[model samples]
Target: MVVEGAGPSCGLIDGFGRHVTYLRLSVTDRCDLRCVYCMSEDMSFRSRRDILTLEELTRLARLFIARGIDKLRITGGEPLVRPGILDLFAALSEPIADGSLRELTLTTNGTQLARFAEDLARAGVRRINVSLDTLDPERFRALTRGGSLARVMDGIAAARAAGLTVKLNVVALKDGTEHEIHDLIAFAHAREMALSLIETMPLGDVGVDRVDQYLPLDSLRRQIAGRWTLHDVPMRSGGPARYARVAETGGLIEFITPHTHNFCADCNRVRVTASGTLHTCLGQDDATDLKAHLRTSATDDVIVRLIDQALGRKPKGHDFILRRGASPQLARHMSETGG
Candidate 1:
């Protein structure tokens, strides 16, 4: 499927016969919360000088769009905490409004969403994924180390009011989560938001052993099936998640099973960190530093060549179980990689 002379096909085809179409662009590594499972409270933050500018991100995104990327998910260490970020959203929307891009979305902690949900919708973002682990305020505070669950609730409501389709992501853990899972599904149903259960992966040195929290997808799905029938929902995007519909509440559920690599067969995304590094795989240490290559002097063809090389080497499956070490292989925190 390659062009007559170019290294790869014009459709952004990878060597594995998968077309990469989704880009998860990180705006900043700085976060507003210190979640125990995501980041350590004493974690050192990167200086603003090392982060990518909004202009650089937008430029790189346009090149990706031309390379067959149709969806962009602006992620971060709570991207809303990044100053002047609404401007980036407005900038990315130009492609969407003009039909060059199919979708533009974001993932946030929802702590600051109450401030910009409507503004973001007006800026051309129609979907958002808010990270919510628990429903109880006390437990939420304990997990996030002082984050206000009330603020997240208000933010979800505000996004809905602004006509944005909202999805809630819950980090599933092995122990003491039976009741919380039920409550989370109920909460999503009440708000008409889809909920996705993400298995806690061994991503960073979050100061806790992941084996203690690594909840299996089967166990969680079995728990949900005990209450409501889950009918499968097929989405066009060949992303990592597989969705299901909850018949009783008319809600949707997505399972992010990196642990089992259930969705790896059709994985179709690459992530760009805030520091302008291209990560072809989320759980792998492989990365291509694109900051220098993406300078003003670099042509679009040059950028595409670099991207083709990266996508060609994209790992087919995440190394979740085959790891030979006790510590996390990926030293960067999830915040630094945009979750």
Candidate 2:
């Protein structure tokens, strides 16, 4: 039954006293490319009937906004690849107009941004995060399993021309990508865009050894400090990344060290998959089947109660360990979890 007058609460506070305000909601679990760190090759995607519809995703977004979620980031294997995705963006932008949502952003692979950047800007999306691990055309192609670097570059340019702020998300790889870090930083700074280096996490068996791919951000930071001065900044982007200012380039750089330095002590975000599974902790397996409640004729109060229960089960922190010949910490791929 549809229950009326179920007003919003103060906010979603977890058992650890962290007020949750940011949500990473996935629109689809399918991507255009097969990144080695994100998923395995020849993978199977969810059937259309298994995923949430645009209307249902929109309703869930509004419910989260009413419950004090200020920042919403739409993610996916590749969100733009989903058909009718612009409709979802337009629908979610409604909360931004009324000030219920502080930001409406997305993290995309940038293959389709050239086609939708203008529409996205018109729909109230102010900023976007584009994943670009390498700048070399051949390396980029190999890294993304045949993705076109030129396409990504064009999409980024189109996004900039459309007046949307862009941030580059790079996955730091130990396999000789360290030498390109300075170049990547220069590229981002030259384009007036912020860049963040992320350490590879053992989320799934991508057919590659985790130990070989793991590049600790702590060591990488020291290496970066040798060439350029990195001054720690107090700025936060409502996520796990720690900010720093590169004195040489006068640009912003960030490090996301899930293993080297855990940010779970002040965790204030939650993630929901395209299938409606609410994961309170990224590394943990505990999840609430939000689709079960969403598909039923459950009222707002019922949904809220389910969310509260899930938050109560949030663990203290994640235990991520990387060793030789070890399996992934979680069986579910990062793609499935809304990377």
List the candidate 1 regions with Cα displacement exceeding 4 Å: 1-9, 234-236, 296-298, 322-325
State residue 175's C-alpha deviation in candidate 2, in Å: 2.2
Compose the digit string of candidate 1's lDDT tens values, residues 1-339. 122233213667677888888899999888888988788778898888788888888888877887778889999888998889988988888889988799999999998878999999998999999999988899889889998999999998899999999999998876646668888898898888999888777777888777776778888899889988999988746876888999999998998888765577777889999999999888889999888776754456666777889999998867776243478767888998986
- Cα error of candidate 2 at position 192, Å: 0.9
Q: List model 2 lDDT by residue over 1-339, tens digit each.
A: 232433346688899888888899999999999998998988888999889999889888888888888999999989999899999999987778988899999999999999999999999999999999999999998888889999999999999999999999999999656888889999999999999889999997899998898888888888889899999999765467899999998999989988898878888899999999999999999989888778885567778787888888888888988889988989988888886
Error of 1 at 186 (Å): 1.3
Model 2: lowest-lDDT 10 consecutive positions: 1-10
Clash count for candidate 2 is: 0
RMSD of each: 3.1, 1.5
Which 10-residue window of candidate 1 scores lowest in summed lDDT? 1-10
TM-score of each model, in listed order = 0.94, 0.97
